[model samples]
Every structure is written in structure tokens, then in C-alpha cells.
Target chain A: EAGVTQFPSHSVIEKGQTVTLRCDPISGHDNLYWYRRVMGKEIKFLLHFVKESKQDESGMPNNRFLAERTGGTYSTLKVQPAELEDSGVYFCASSLTGRHSYEQYFGPGTRLTVT
Target chain B: AQSVTQPDIHITVSEGASLELRCNYSYGATPYLFWYVQSPGQGLQLLLKYFSGDTLVQGIKGFEAEFKRSQSSFNLRKPSVHWSDAAEYFCAVGLAYSGGGADGLTFGKGTHLIIQP
Candidate 1:
């Protein structure tokens, strides 16, 4: 089985520009999650999706950040008017369940650089 | 809020030497602990996990971690370090036990391991 895959391995854009990161979870996986790690910081949770429904989104940094999972297949994270502080590695993970303590498979991550 | 702390920012070990990386966590209940390794240009890979029962759990790549409830710690260890072991190690914690699915993880800043040949 193929692991979680992410698009646009690296993204470079100017401040105020918009960027979208995509993630394709493993086949038959119902739980998808988003996390980001800023330089010199820990990886922080962004949000989670159980199929097409949002299970939890308390980790979203601000209003400019938005996440969506369509058709319960893949997910996208959009940062509108990205800021310099927004530059970091965005990671997507998926698991068979949405409860807790189960291992999550992670992607290579999308490195976003907002200048 | 759940959180993890890795006291060592970086560690250097000679090839074939024993290795240990410290991890401390603060959570309300019995924490679900995990250790993951990130190679250069790669995603995080699970090394091992501690949920219940055994306090010491073995994982892939000859890695192991001991969960100490008294210390509120889950530390990773290896009997002998290999050059390929040079990577960033992250300690994460989760709440509850989900056999079917897992929730979002709270990760530490990570420890960069340096293997000297």
C-alpha cells in the first residue's frame, strides 16, 4: 500500500500571496490530520478530518488558514495572505481510525517559504 | 493541553556506542507515548509506542522506549548506534487509546542525533 503523499514538496511565495498544500492519504484511511513545524519550533497540530467532516480544528493558527477534505479522499490546506511567519514544513498524516493513540502515517511534508 | 519536551536539543554518539534520548511530557492522564525518527528529506517514521501493559516497548530499526509513569517520561534508547541512526528524533503524546483510529499528535521540538564514525 502506498503511504501518504503530498504535493508541491516545496513552495516559495511572497508575503500576502496565497498557497495551497495538498495531501493524499493512504487507501481506505478515514482519518486525516494536518500539522506544521516552524523553524526552531515543535510540530504543532493544525486540524483533523474524519472522512469529509471536520473532527477537530482547534489547532488552526488564524482565520487566514483553512483546511478541507473533499469526497473523503484527499485534503487541502490553504493559507490566504501568507505571512513571513507562515513559512515552515506542513505535514499531513492519516490513520485507519479517528479515536486516539493509533499510529499515524506521515508524508514527506511541504516546505513553505513565504518571503 | 498535552505537550512533550526533549531536554537534549542535539546529541553526539560514536558509532557502536549506546544511545539514549530523554523525553518528558505533561498530560492529565496516562499518556499515549510514541517515538518517531525523521531522516534527512524524509517524513517521520515510528520507532516505537507505549500505550499500556508493558512499560518497555520495542520498535523498528532496533529502537526501544521505556514509559515511566512516575517520571512522566518516555525515553528512546538503542544498544548500539549506527551511522544511519543520525536523524531527528521526535517525542509525541496523545490522549486516550484508539485501536481503530488516532487523533492529532502533540510533538516535541525534536532531538538531532549526530553519529560519529
Candidate 2:
């Protein structure tokens, strides 16, 4: 069983540019989550997906950020008009849906640098 | 809302020495606690978790954490530090929803562990 996997381990873009980060969860996992960690700051939750539907998105930072899980297979986080403050590591995690949902497995985060 | 605090920003321990990293949390009910480690160029890895029953939980890579309800703390410990143990350790609290699926986690700033040779 492969752990969660993310695309484009590192991304560098200018402010106001759009960037999309992708995550492929483990096979048969129904729960997916997104989290971000700015430099010297704690990792903060962004949103969560149960299959193709959004479970919770209260943690989303701003309107410019959007997350989607299509076909209940993978997830994508898009940051439009990215700002300098958006430079950080974005992590995606996944787990089962039942009693073991708390046990989340993370992916190698995508380090985004917005200059 | 739940929150986590790691008092130590960084810690240095000699190889083979004992290690302890402090973590404090604030939540209403019995919190779900977790400890995760992130090595250089690696993703966050779950070390251990405490939901109920046992206060002391053992995890991978010879790591263990004790959950103390009185102190509102869950501290990670290792009997002997290894060079490979040098990494960033994060203490987190998972919000349990009554509905079903797991919610997002609240994480601490993380403690950077330095292993001296």
C-alpha cells in the first residue's frame, strides 16, 4: 500500500500567479485533508474531503484558495493570484473513513515559493 | 477550537542520551493526541497517538508519548537518541466530530531536535 503522494514536490512562482497542487491518496481511502505550514509557523488545517464532497472547509485561509476532490480519487488545491505569504509547504493527508479515521497518513509536502 | 503548544523551539541531545519533548494542549473534552516527526526532505510521519484507555502509547522508531489529562499534556520520549532522530517533531490535536469522518488537526509549531555526535 503506497502512502499519500503529491505532485511537483517544489514549485516557484511569482505573486499573482496561479498554482495548483495535487495529491493522490492511498487506495480505498475515503478521507482526504489539506494542511499548510508557513515558515516558523505551526501547520494549520485548510480543508477536508470525504470522497467527492467537502466535509469541512472552515480552515481555508481566504477566497483565493480552493480545494477539490474529483471522482473521490484525488485532490487538488488551487491558489489563484498567489501572494508572498502563500509561500510555504502544503501537505495532503488521507485515512480510512470508519473508526480509524484519526490515523492520517501524510505525503511529501509541496514547497511553494511565491516571490 | 483546539490548540497545541510545544514549549521547546529546539533541543540538543548527545547521541545515546535520553530525550523528552514537551507538549501541551487545550480542548474541552478528552482530546485525541498525536505526535509526528518530519525528517529532512521527508513528509510528516505519525509517531504515536492516544485516543482512550492507555495513557502511555508506543509508536514507530522507538518513540513513545504519555498522555496526562491532569496536565493537558502529551509528551514524546525516547530512551536513547539516535542521529536519525534529528528532525522536527509536531504535537497535534485531532477534533473528533460526532457525525463520522475525521476532522482537520491543530498542530504545534514543532520542536527541532539536534543530535550531537
Candidate 3:
């Protein structure tokens, strides 16, 4: 089976511009999560989606960032009016279920650079 | 608040040597612990997890970790190190879904493992 896939492995955009990163989870996975690593920082959770429903979004930094998982299959994280500080790597992962014990499979991640 | 700490920022060991990476966590209740490895420009890969039972848990690539509740530590170990084992290892603590409803993982600043051929 193919693992989780992410598009545009790397992206570069100007400050105040918008960018959308996409992720396609593994087949039959019901739980999807978004995380990112800023420069010199640990990977931090952004949000989680369980079959098209937002389970937890506490880690989202601000309102300029939005994530959507339509049709419960793939997800897209859009950043509007992106700031220079938003440059980092964004990772997407999926799990077979939302249960606490299941392991999550991750994608290669998209590196976004805001100039 | 729940947090994870990886004491060593980096470690270098010769091939065929034993390796240990320390992890510490702070949470009110019994926390679910996990260890993940990431190669350069790659995504994180789950090595192993500790939920309940058997303090010693085996993971992929002959890696293992021991959970010690008394010390609030879960340290990853390997009997023999390989050149391919060079990567960044991260320790994370999973918070239970409760009244506070925190259902995500808190990760530690990873430890970069270096292998000398």
C-alpha cells in the first residue's frame, strides 16, 4: 500500500501571499493530523481531523491559518497573508483509527519558505 | 501541563556500540509515550510506543525503550548501533482525552544520533 503523500514537496512564497499545502492520507485511514516545525523548534500540532470533523485545533497559531478535509479523504492547509515567521516544514499523518494506541503514518512533509 | 524532555541534544557512537537516548515526561496521570525517528528531509516514523504492561517495548530496526514510572522517564536503547541509525530521535507524550479534552501529543526537542563507521 502506498504511504501518505504530500504535494509540492517544497514551496516558496512572498510575505503576505497565500499558499495551500495538500495531503492525501493512506487508504482506509480515519484520522488525519497536521503538524509543523519552525526553525529551531520542535514539531508542533496544528489540528486534527477525524472523518471530516475537526477533533482538536488548539495548536493552531492564529486565524490566518485554516485547514479543511473535504470528503473525509484528503486535507488542505491554507495560510493567508503568510508571514515570514511562517516558514517551516508542514507534515501530515494518518492513523487507522482515532484510538489512542494506533500508530500514525506520516508523509514526507512540505517545506514552506516565506520570503 | 504535559511536556517531554530529551536531555541530550546529540550523541555519537561507533558502529557495534550500545546506544541510549534518554527521554523524560511530566504529566498528572499515566501518559502514553512514543519514540519516533526522522531522517534528513523525511517525515517522522514511529519506532515504538508505551501504553501499558511490560516496561520494555521493542520497536522496528532492533530498537527498544524502557519506561520507568518512578523516574518519569522512557529511554530508547539499542544493543548495537549501525551507520544507518543516524537520525533525529524524538520522544513524545500523548495526553488522554478527558474533561480538559487535550487529545494530542506533546513532543520533546529531538536528539540527533550520529554513527561513526
Candidate 4:
């Protein structure tokens, strides 16, 4: 089975511009998640989805960030009017839903640079 | 709120030497512990996990971690390190979900391992 894959491994955009990062999870996985790691900081959770419905979004930093999972297949994270502080590595992960399925497989991560 | 701490920012070990990376966690309830490694230009890979039961857990790549409830620590260890073992290691704690799946995780800043030959 393929692990999670992210698009545009690296992205460079000007401040105030919008950017969207996509993630294609492993086949048949129902749990999808987004996390971000700023330079010199720990990786932090952004949101989670279970079959197209958001399971938790408390970790979202602000209103400018948006995430969606359509048809329970893939996920997208959009940052509108991106700011310089939004520059970081965004990671997408997926896992199966079951009693013993506690492992979450991660993607290579998209490195976003906002100048 | 739950948090994880990797005390060592970086560690250097000679090849074939024993290795131990310290990790400390603070959580209200029982948490699901995990260790992950990321090589240059590679994604994070799960090394091992601790949900319950045995305190010592073996993982891929000949790595192991000991969970100590008394100390609130989960330290990763390797008896003999190799040159390829150089990478960044992360320690995380996941919230327990009622449905049995692990929820979002709280991660440490990570430790960079430098293996010397």
C-alpha cells in the first residue's frame, strides 16, 4: 500500500497570497489529519477528518486557515492571505479506524515559504 | 493540555556505540506514546508505539523504547548505532479516543542524532 503523498513538495509565495496544499492518503483509510511545523518549533496538529466530516479542528491557529476532505478520499489545506509566519512544513497523515489501529502514517510534507 | 519534551536537542554517537534519547511527557490521562524518525528529505516514519502493557517496546530498525510511568518518560534506545542511524527523532503523545483510534498528537521539538564512524 502506498503511504500518504503531498503535492508541490516545496512552495514559495509572497505574503498576502493564497496557497493550497493537497494530500492523497492511502487507499481505504478513513482518518486524515494535517499538521504543521514551523522553523525551530515542534510539529502541531491542524485538523482531522473522518470520511469527509471533520472530527476535530481545535488546533487550527486562526480563521485564515481552512481544511477540507471531500468524498472521504483526499484532503486540502488552504491558507488565504498567507502571512510570513505561515511559512513552515505542512504534513498530512492517514490511518485506519479500528481498535488496534493507532499508528498514523505521515507524508513527506510540503515546505511553504511565504516572503 | 498535553505536551512532550525531548531533552536533547542533538546527540553525537560513534558507530556501534549504545544510544539513548530522552523523552518526557505531561498529560492528564493515560496517553498513547510514539517515536518517529525522519531522514533527510524523507517523511516521518513510526519507529515504535506504546499504548499499554509492556513497558519496553521494540521497533523497526533495531530500535526500542522503555516507558516508565513513574518518571513519565518514554526513552528510545539502540544497543549499537549505525552510520545510517543519523536522523531527527520525535516523541509524541496522543489523546485517547473513545472509539479506540488515537486522536491528534502532541509532539516534541525533536532530537537530531549524529552518528560518527
DockQ metric for all predictions: 0.68, 0.87, 0.49, 0.81
Q: What TM-score would you give candidate 2 relative to the actual structure?
A: 0.98
When candidate 3 is compared with the true two-chain complex, its DockQ is: 0.49
User: Which candidate, 1 or 2, has the higher TM-score?
Assistant: 2
True contacts preserved, each candidate? 0.85, 0.79, 0.48, 0.83
Q: lDDT of all the models against the reference? A: 0.91, 0.94, 0.90, 0.93
Which residues of candidate 3, in runs, are more than 4 Å off? Answer: A98-101, B98-102
Show where candidate 1 strays beyond 4 Å.
A98-101, B97-101
Query: Using DockQ as the measure, what is the rank order of every candidate, best first?
Result: 2, 4, 1, 3
User: After best superposition, candidate 2 residue A104: deviation in angstroms?
Assistant: 0.4
Q: Against the correct fold, how does model 3 do in TM-score?
A: 0.95
lDDT of 3 by residue, B20-40 (tens): 999999988878889999999
TM-score of 1: 0.96
Which CAPRI quality tier does the interface of model 4 achieve?
high
- Candidate 4 chain A weakest ten by summed lDDT: A95-104
Clashing pairs in 1: A97-B101, A98-B101
Weakest lDDT window of 10 consecutive positions for candidate 2 chain B: B93-102
Best by lDDT: 2
Candidate 2 lDDT over B72-103, as tens digits, reads 99999999999999999999999776657579
What are the RMSD figures for all models against the true structure? 1.7, 0.8, 1.9, 0.9
